[model samples]
Target chain A: MKARVTITLKPGVLDPQGKAIEHALDNLGFSGVEAARAGKVIELDLADGTSDADIDAMCRKLLANTVIENYRIERL
Target chain B: MKARVTITLKPGVLDPQGKAIEHALDNLGFSGVEAARAGKVIELDLADGTSDADIDAMCRKLLANTVIENYRIERL
Candidate 1:
């Protein structure tokens, strides 16, 4: 089984890297961009029968910093 | 308009970070994870009517390292 875990910073969190990207975009003449947020993607190739609960635990325990980020699980 | 660009390392490329994450997951007791590849997600808020072609250009020019990374664009 394959799954994707996306970890995004919650609203109001300070994202310095994101800010830097936004600035770079502006300098690169992509002024149409209003905002930019950078996040992490973890693509997992798992053994068959890995449950959704274990996937969720993976995000909570290590994949995401829960205090500042939220994660979504997508089974593929 | 909203779009997401996912940039992943091409297969066969050396990914030290991915290997590190796999090791960490094993130590954290997630033995079912056969492989883990880390990637980047860039979420963009754009002006209305931002064309798909522009998004593609963004990825090719800045959001991804075309030499080693492949990127997918998702319109949200």
Candidate 2:
């Protein structure tokens, strides 16, 4: 099975990395970019028949800091 | 308008961060993970009518390193 985990900061969380990118883009003369939020995407190759619950558990246990980030799982 | 840029290492490139994650997952007892690839996702809040060419330019010039990375842009 193949799964993709997208981890993003929760709303209202400060993202210094994202802010840095935004500023860099502006300095590069690509104007009109209101904001940018940086996040992580992890693609996993798993054994066939890996259950959704197991995937969720992986996200909660290690893939994400639940207090400040959110994760979405997609099985492919 | 909103846009997303997904930046991933080109196949065959070494990814130490991903390997570290794979090892950590194994140590944490989540088996069946054959491999893992780490990537970045940047969400952009842009002015309405931002052109696709402009977005592509952003990816090529700063958002991704074309020599060892691949980037996909999606408009939302």
Q: TM-score of every model?
A: 0.97, 0.97
TM-score of chain B of each: 0.95, 0.97
Tens-digit lDDT track for model 2 on A1-76? 8999999999999999999999999999999899999999999999998889988988998899999999999998
Could you tell me the C-alpha RMSD of candidate 2 in Å? 0.7
lDDT at A7 for candidate 2?
96
Among the numbered candidates, top TM-score falls to 2
Task: Give candidate 1 misplaced runs (Cα > 4 Å).
Answer: none
Backbone clash pairs for candidate 1 read none
Q: List fnat, each candidate.
A: 0.85, 0.85
- Which pairs clash in model 2? none
- The TM-score of chain B in candidate 2 is 0.97
lDDT tens digits by residue: candidate 1, A1-76: 9999999999999999889888888898888899999999999999999999999998988889999999999999
Query: Each candidate: what lDDT?
Result: 0.92, 0.94
